[model samples]
Target: MNITVFCSAYSLDDRYSVPAAEFARLLGSGGHTLVWGGSNAGLMGLLADEVKAAGGRLVGVLVELLAHKGYQGADELVMTADLAARKAELLARADAVVVLAGGLGTLDEVTEVVELRKHGLHDKPIVLLDTEGFYAGLRTQLERMEAEGFLPRPLAELVSFAGTPAEVFELLAAAS
Candidate 1:
């Protein structure tokens, strides 16, 4: 599977890094490809390193402004003119999407994908790894949206939340 992962570009605490690394190892050892932002910084860099070390293929989609920060060892790298194009390319390359703990940028990426799925623009499975309940607030908001009839489809059908690295793969496997 070509898994597109949206995550922090900033160096994170061990609490977040540990799970991200575990997820990377699984993606690599399982003979999958990682499709992500083409940055060799922070958590994004760590994920690429772990995945590459574990034998996974890396495909990076980078925006022009961040091209200088692109990973040196990606199996393939694509340069986009802007963030919107980058997101489009990322989704176009992914068989599924996995979101790890991140700040606003990561949130933006995941939100766009989810919205696309909700509009029937794509059917790819989207999973969020809720490490340390980092996504609890978002989950509550989404649940409220579901309860309020704001969404046309069931919340479960739109996205699934997993609590660990193993659970992320288990959900992906079942979805595939």
Candidate 2:
């Protein structure tokens, strides 16, 4: 399985390394490939490093601007001129998406995946690693969209939520 992990650039820290490593270890143990933002910082960095350390094939997709931010870790790099292009490239090849706790950038990328599911552009599974209920408000707003009929129920269900990386990876493996 090839999984694309959607995550925030801001939340990268040593604190996040263990869970990231756990997720990578699980996937590596299962003989799956890991794909993610090619960043050297935050959760993105941790995931790529651990996945590679665990002997998994890791691919990094990064936008030009973000790459200049000095936060990328792709043994193999895909450089896009911009963020939108970066997402497009990832969407083209990733069979699944796991969203770790992140901020606006993370939200933006996840929104693209949601919209992609909405339009039937892809049936790829999306799992949200809630990480301490990081996505509580976001889920509420998505539910509100469902209530307003702005988003269909099935579309809203495109994203599964888990409080731990273990659960998120389980959902992702099932998706595969």
Candidate 3:
């Protein structure tokens, strides 16, 4: 299945490089497509590199603006004219989304999916790969949404949390 993973160009330890690369390899080996930001720096770079090394298809969606800001481009990428076009392409191509540990950038992505489902734009599954309690706070916020009237309990059920790379990928496989 074509699975898009939303992540950032950096990792906190900044040690997220290896894990991102490893996750890409694992997904590739499991016959899943690797989709991410088109950059060859930090986690973004490692993810694409790992996918290429594993002989898996790596598709990158990047805005012409941030293409070089991150240092490089994806192994298999098609440049977009602007951020809007890039995002549209990324969302259109993926069957499912797996959000790994990321900073504000990743948070924006996950929230976009939530908003999409909330507005009835789409009903795609969103899997949060919360390694090391990365998404604990976001999870809490979502739970609060369900508690209040801001988000319906049924709509809030759209997102799933997976604590490990193995668990997240397994969920992806099951979606097929």
Candidate 4:
């Protein structure tokens, strides 16, 4: 599987980093590839490192503006003209999407993918690794959207939540 991961470009606390690393290890040892933002800055870099250490392939989709921060050892790197194009390419290359605890950029990536799935543009399975209940509020808001008919499809069908790295893979496997 070419698992596209959305995560922070800034350094994060162990509370977030530890689980993210575990997830990376799992992805690699499972003989999967990582498709992600091509940044060697923080959490993203850590994920690439762990995944590579565990023998996974890395494919990075990067925006031209952040080219200076690109990962040096990705198995393949793709450059996009802008953020929108970068997001598109990331989704284009992924078999599935996994979101880890991150900031605005990560949130934006996940939202666009879910919106696309809801619209039937794609049928990829989207999973959020809700480490430490990091996504509780987002889950609540999405449930409300489903309850209020704001979404065209059931929220659960568009996305699923997993509490651990193992659960993320299990959900992905089940979805496939």
- The TM-score measured for candidate 1 stands at 0.99
lDDT per residue, candidate 1, 37-93, as tens digits? 989999999999999999999999999999899999999999999999999999999
Give candidate 4 regions above 4 Å deviation: none
Q: After TM-score superposition, what is the CA distance of residue 84 in candidate 1 from its true location, in Å? A: 0.2
lDDT tens digits, residue span 1-176, model 2: 78888876655554455666687777766676777778877777767767777777877887787766544445578888888888888878688888877778888999989888987889999888776667888888888787788875554357888877679777766766
Question: What's the lDDT for residue 119 in model 1?
Answer: 98
TM of each candidate vs. truth: 0.99, 0.87, 0.88, 0.99
Per-candidate Cα RMSD to the true structure, in Å, reads 0.5, 2.3, 2.2, 0.5
On TM-score, who's better, 2 or 4?
Answer: 4
lDDT of 4 by residue, 1-176 (tens): 99999999999899999999999999999999999999999999999999999999999999999999999999999999999999999999999999999999999999999999999999999999999999999999999999998999999899999999999999999999
Model 1 residue pairs with clashes = none
The C-alpha local distance difference test score for the whole of candidate 3 amounts to: 0.74
Q: Estimate every model's Cα lDDT from 0 to 1.
A: 0.96, 0.76, 0.74, 0.96
Q: What lDDT score is found at residue 59 in candidate 1? A: 99
Score residue 69 of candidate 4 by CA lDDT. Answer: 98
